[model samples]
Target: MAKILVVDDEAHIRELIRLYLVDEGFEVIEKANGEDALAYAENQSVDLAIIDIMMPKLDGWDLCKELRELDEMPILMVTSKGEAQDKIKGFKLGTDDYLVKPFDPVELVLRVKALLKRYRIDASSLIKLGSIMLDRRTYQVIYKDGNQVTIPMKEFELLYKLGSYTNQLFTRDHLIEQIWGMDYEGDERTVDVHIKRLRERFAEFESDFKIVTIRGLGYRLEVYRD
Candidate 1:
């Protein structure tokens, strides 16, 4: 069963979220303030977290920053502010998604469902392309006969995105936006560097998966036969 931690200052809202989450067959834990929520998030084995932005101890943004340092579990922020800046801040902090106050319980559950679906796919730990396997969680890629290739996280994120969306042409900006996020302040050419590194690793490991650059566009992952 998935464990969900809900943090909301208002007792009613917390209860409402907890009820729906529990009814959805998830194990739900509730906290009333960001302080306690941060503590549990830092120490406990929570699969997902829903934090209220406006809280007494620590605001949702601070809590999110602190928690993200320790865990990458999906975090859904609930706020009443309804500002684009606030939403951007949440996403920039690596939050999976955000919601505003006066939210529908069903919609909340739906977000949770969508988040969990992506989480499950990500947590699979194995990215299979024909006979090649890339494990993001373990940072390992093995050939069909079990040869190993080592790839770093940024490279892995890039390769994972490529292999996940095989044959889809993504420009440098698009790759930066999806892989790095909109608020990321980095050079667009960094994508080229990572791609160069990825190709080197793939060649050295003699893997059948290759990343191809689309001249005026960007790169993609295709089977060696492609």
Candidate 2:
């Protein structure tokens, strides 16, 4: 059973989430504050985390960042704030998914399952998208025509990440943290530059997949289906 850490300031909210998750055969650990949640994660094994934005000690934003830095476990942010900017902030902080308040418990469970599945796919060293295959182990892009291209380390990683979760949106901040390390001091435009290079290098593979810029957001890989 996968262990889930649920951090919410409201007792009822935590209970509601726990009841539903436990029903799905998941092990749930409840924390009323981000500090306690972070402490638990550091000392224990957690497969995923459900965080609330408004908490007494160390809000969900910081907690999400801390957990992401700790490992690649998926994070789901549940908050009453439904504003677009707030959602963007959560994504930038590395939350894998988000849920607004008054959300159906069923939907929450579905999102949890989806995130787990997505992460499982991401764990693989090889990602096959349409006609192209990304070999993470060798940092090579193998085409259907038997042509292979090896790109820079950063470019390969960025492409691998996007292709791993095709059609999923990724904010620049999140990509920077995942590809460049949290301690990277370069500008966010570094992602833009690398993305441009990837586009140019794989321009002919448009039929297989394309990296799209979601204005004001970031980027997503779109794989064409036959």
Candidate 3:
């Protein structure tokens, strides 16, 4: 489901938009004004944002500008006023689409869906580490020597990230922040535990297939083919 940020002062408008988007299979996040919208955008991942122009603290143009600086997520500026200057300002601030108020709710939904479809991502479809193969879409981990492991959520993510980058080492502190979010509430030792479990799981294939520890630096996946 696509995550959408709806920034509007009117509670009725927020509810109206949320209802419409949710019906269309979107995950809607509602913010009453520009400041809270900005804060949400900085932390959460949003596929698209619908920003209203006449808002408290920071207006839509300024809010869009701030969001553009932080993330490349597509933005749609909505305003009651359909002035050319307002449209230009939003476009200059890097908004992907725009809608004027008193607009059709269906049109907004269509626009949101179209924007996401047009900007779809084709990220690396697969990640491989040693004899382990990770299928990005299916989220499957298979060993080359015939053993297979089906990982659950975070564990799968941790291994996939390590596999995706191959030989680049990442410290436990770094993995906690990167694989887990920066706001991860877990201890640093969580990385060590997961790595240990992963190593144990892979032991059926080869005792030497590497997730090497660099003493204090941390772990890297390295198995010499020679």
Candidate 4:
């Protein structure tokens, strides 16, 4: 059973989340504030974390920064503040996903599972294609000529999944399920956005492969050999 850490100031909210998480066969660890949550994280092997931003004693943002410094465990931010800036801040602090208040328990569970799946895939292997090398140990990509670029969490996972099986076509729905989770109710175009950003970022470096679209199917990483 995977262990999940839930941090919220409200007892009812914590219990609500716990009920659903436990029903899904996850071990639940609860904390009312970020202070306690941070302590628990340091001493425990938490697979994922759901944090409330408006808590007393070390808010979610601070705790997120602290935990991000320690490990790459997936972090999800839940709060009443649903502004774009808040979500962006959470992402910048290394949060894997953001859910606003009044969220559905089912959606929460889906996100949790999705994050765990993505994390497992990321930690499973190190991938190298031609001059580009993805080193999971350092969470970075290095080129044959020693040029290093640190990819964001989501982008890194996207690259890993695509590059893991070169020339294999992955449909958009499959990628969303594998990378974003089953309950991702967002637009499918989101995948295109991420892929475009990946291409743009890698364009600066020398890489032997490119992520290509399969015309109505999805995308694939095509490696061109010299």
In lDDT terms, which candidate is top? Answer: 2
**In model 4, which regions exceed 4 Å deviation?**
121-226
Q: Which 10-residue window in model 2 sums to the lowest lDDT?
A: 120-129
lDDT of 4: 0.87
TM-score of each: 0.52, 0.53, 0.55, 0.53
RMSD of 1: 14.8
Candidate 3: lDDT of 43?
87
lDDT of 1 by residue, 40-94 (tens): 8777878888998888989888888887777778899997855667887788788
Candidate 3 segments exceeding 4 Å error: 121-226
Instruction: Score candidate 2 by lDDT.
Output: 0.89
As a whole number from 0 to 100, the lDDT of residue 13 in candidate 2 is 92
Off by over 4 Å in 1: 121-226
**lDDT per prediction?**
0.83, 0.89, 0.80, 0.87
Give candidate 2's total backbone clashes: 0
The ten-residue window of minimal lDDT in model 3 covers 121-130
lDDT by residue (36-118, candidate 3, tens digit) is 99998888877788989999898888888888888878888787864768877777777898888788999999898888877
Clashing pairs in 2: none
| lDDT tens per residue, model 2, 1-226 | 5788999999999999999999987889999999999999999978999999889989999999999999889999987854667898887777889998989999999999999888883332568878888888689988889898888999999999998798999999999999889999989999999999999988987887899999999999999963
Which model scores highest in TM-score?
A: 3
Q: Ranking by lDDT, best first?
A: 2, 4, 1, 3
